[model samples]
Target: MKKENLPPFKITNEILTLIYEIGELIGKISVTQEFEKNLILRRENRIKTIYSSLAIEQNTLTLEQVTDVINGKRVLAPLKDIKEVQNAYEIYERLDELNDNSVKDLLLAHKIMTSELIKENGKFRSKNAGVYQGEKLIHMGSMPAHIPELINNLFLWLKNSKEHPLIKAAVFHYEFEFIHPFQDGNGRIGRLWHTLILSKWKDFFGWLPIESLVQKYQKEYYTAINNSNRDGESTEFILFMLKIINETLIELIENQKMTDKMTDKMTDKNKKRIEVILKYLSQKNYIDNKEAQNLLDVSEATAKRFLNKLVKENILEAVGEYKARKYIKK
Candidate 1:
C-alpha cells in the first residue's frame, strides 16, 4: 500500500492503558533477576517450540507428527528428520554472537536453518521467484538477478531505518515473507529472522512471544499479507503486528500480576519452594525427583512430596514413567 493510504500507527486509549499496565509488570519482573530469567526462558522455549511446529506443519516432515514433535511430547506420529530443528536451535543459540549488520550472518542463519529444504541454503536463489495465491501468482515482483546485491540492499534498509522497532520488524517480516528468498522454508525462516532483528533492537522484545500471538491469529496473519499484496507494500500487515504486540504485552502483564498475587499469599517455605521450582525451570522445562532434591536441599521423599503437592495444587504438571517422572510449571 502507498504510505498515504496506510492506516496510522496510532495507539488507542485502550492500548495505551494496556501498555501502561504492561510497563508496570515489566518493571516488577525486572526487579528480580530470577523472575526475569524465568520469563525469558519460557518465552524463548515457546517461540522455538511454536516455530518448529509451524515448520513441521508445512509438509517438510514426511513421517513426523509435527504437533507432538514440537511440544517435546511422546506420540505415535511418524518422525521426520529433525535436522531443521537442530539448525534452527543452533542459529537461535548464536544470536547474541552476531555483532555486525552484514548480510553474511543473516544469510548464514537462513542457510543453516533451511538447508534441508532448499538447494541454496547459505546462498541466494539464482532464478526468478514470485508469491502465489492458490494456482495463480499474486504479485508480479522479481528479485535482482544478483541475489547478494538485493539482500545487501534489504539489510541496508533494515539497518538504517528510524521507524518504530515494532513497525520495522513487522514490515521486514512481511517483505521477507513476500520475497520468499529461499526455495523452501521461507515462511519459517522469515519469521525467525524477523524475531532475531527485533531482539537486536530491544532486549525486552527477545522475551516476547510474537509468534504465539500470530499463531493464535493465523487467518488474520495470512489475510494481512494477502490484503497488502492486492495493493502494494505491507501497511496492513504492519498494523496487524503492532496490534498483536500490544495484545501479547497485555497478556504478559496479566500473567505477571497473577503470579505475583499467588506468590504473595504463600508462606516463606512455600515461597522458597516456588523459587526452587522456578530456578529449575529456567534451566530446563522438566525437573525430576533427584534434581528437585538437590535444588531444594531436601531428602528424596521430601522432594517427591513437595513436587506432588505442587502438582496437586495445579502449579506443576507431571509426566513420564513413575520412576522417571518429571514436573513442569503448569
Candidate 2:
C-alpha cells in the first residue's frame, strides 16, 4: 500500500467548547418526547434534509416538489432533476447499507447519488480537476493517478485515528472536498459521507439536516474550504462545521421546547381526542367530518368541532371547503 500524507488538523478551544455545547444539546434532544413521539415532525425533518442537501448542488426542485417525489406523486420536473431527487431519496432510505469507513461503500454512494447526472458516476476521475469561481481556479485536486490511493489512505487514517468522531468527520469532509475523488457529485457525496460518519456514532444525526444550515451559510462554507486549503490543514473548516453542528442542535432543542409547550396547552379531553385522531390518521392519512364522527362515535356537529379544533391548533390541516373539507395530520 502507498503511504500518503494525510492533511493535519487539531482540536482547539473553540472546537472543544462547541463539542461540549453540542453534547448538552444532544442530551436535551434525546430526552425530549416531541421528536421521538411525533411521527409527523420526524417525517418533516427528513424532507427538509433531502430538500436542502439537493438544493446545495443546484437542484431546482422546491421543498413541496421534493415532498411530492418522496410520496410517489408525479410532478413536472426535468428528467435529470427528478432522477436526482429519486437517487438521493433512495440513498437516504438505504443509509444503513453503506458503511461509513469503507472506501468501496463510498463508491457505491457516488453511484447512487449521481446515477443519471454523470457518465462515470461511481468511478474516480481519470483527469485532473480544480475548484473554480467563474474564471479563477481556487483549489486543484491531487493528480488523477493518485486519486484512489489518496482516498484509501484517508479512510485508513479514519480507521486508525483516535480523534473524536466529531473532529474526524469534519477532517474527512474537508479532505474529501480537497481530493475531489469523483467526476461529479463530489459535493453531495462529501456531505452525505459526513452525515454517515456522524450517524454511525449517533443515529439521530441520520435525520438531522446539517446541510440545511450549510445551505444557509454557503458563502462561509466555501470560504472555510478555501481557507483550509490555503493553510494546508483542515482546522478552519473543522471549526466552521463544528459551530454549524452546534447551532443546528440548539435549533432542535429550542423548537422541541416550543412544541412541548404548545402540546401542553391543549385541554385534557382535546388531548385524548387528538391522540385518537392521530392513531386513525396513521392508518387513513386523512379524515373528513363523517369519517371522524364514525371513528370517534361522536355526533356530526361534535365531529366537526373536534376536527376544526385540531386544525386550529395546527396539529391537523384542513383541505377543501366547508362540507367537503378533510383533515390530515400536519
Candidate 3:
C-alpha cells in the first residue's frame, strides 16, 4: 500500500486561546449542579445537533421532525431526509463503539449514516468526486485509487501524533474533507467523526453539540474549508472549529446558569430526584414508573410524584396510558 504523508497544519495564538477559553468554561461547568445532572438540556442539545448537522447538508427536515423521527413517530418529509435522520441517530447512539483511529470503523460509520440513501453506503468511491458551489468546482478530491492509502496514512498519523486531541481532531476533519473519501455523505461523516475523536478524549464532548454552532455559521464553515484548501494547511479550519467549540462550551455554561436560577427554589429532595431521573434518562432515553422506582430505590407513589412534577415543570414529556406511562426528556 502507498503511504501518504499527513497534511501539515500550524497552530496559532488563536487556536491556543480558544482552547484555553473552552477549558475554562468546561472547568466552570464541571462544578455546576447541572453539568452532568441536566438531563433535559442534554437531550435538547442532542436534537439540535442532529437537526443542524443534517440541515447543513440540505436535509429539509425541521427540528420538530427530527425529534418526532427520533421518537419513532411518522414524519411527512422526503424519504431521503427521514432516512438520513434515522441513520445519523443510529450512528450517534452507538458512538462509543466506534474507533477513531480505525479506517474500517470509519467506513462502517459511513455505511450506517448513509444507509438506504447511497448504493455504496459504507465504501469509498471508485470514481473521482468534486465539491461544487452551484456550477463552480471548489475542490476536486484525490484520485479514487489513492483514497484507501491516503486515509490509512491519515489514521496512522492520528494514532501516532502527539498533538492535542482538539487540534488532532480538527486537522483530521479538514483532511477528511480534502480527501473526500466517499462519493456521498463525506461532509456529515467528517463532522460526526470529529465529535467521535473528541469524545474519545473527553466523554463530555460526546454531547457537546458543536455542530449546532457550525450550522449557524454555515458560510464561514465552507469558507474556512476552502481557504484551508487554498493554503494547503489546516490552520484556518482548526481556528474556525476551535471557535465553534469554544462558543458551544460557553453556551453550555450559560444554560447551566439559567438552570441554576430556575431551580433555585427546588427542594433538595426534589433536586436529588431530578438528578437521579436525568441519569436514568440519559442511559435509557425514557423512564417508566417501575423503572424509575427501581433506579431510584423509591416507592411507586414517590416515583410517580417526582415524574409528574418534572412533567408539570416542562422538564419531561409524559407519554402513553396512565398505568403504562413513561417520562421522556423534553
Which has the greatest lDDT? 3
What TM-score would candidate 3 get against the native? Answer: 0.80
Better by lDDT, candidate 3 or 1: 3
lDDT of 1 by residue, 180-279 (tens): 6665566766776667776786565655667767767887888888887765667677767767777776776676666776687689998878876875
Which pairs of residues clash in candidate 2, taking residues 3 or more apart in a chain or in different chains?
none
Ranking of all predicted structures according to lDDT, beginning with the best and ending with the worst: 3, 2, 1
Against the hidden true structure, what lDDT does model 3 obtain? 0.86
Q: List the global CA lDDT of all models.
A: 0.65, 0.84, 0.86
Candidate 1: Cα lDDT at 247: 75
TM-score of 1: 0.70
Worst 10 residues of 2 by lDDT: 1-10
Instruction: Please give the lDDT score at residue 147 for candidate 2.
Output: 89
Model 2 Cα shift for residue 11 (angstroms): 1.7
Q: What does candidate 2's lDDT look like per residue over 252-281, in tens digits?
A: 887777556656988887666776787666
Ranking, TM-score, top scorer first: 2, 3, 1
TM-score for each predicted model, relative to the true structure: 0.70, 0.83, 0.80
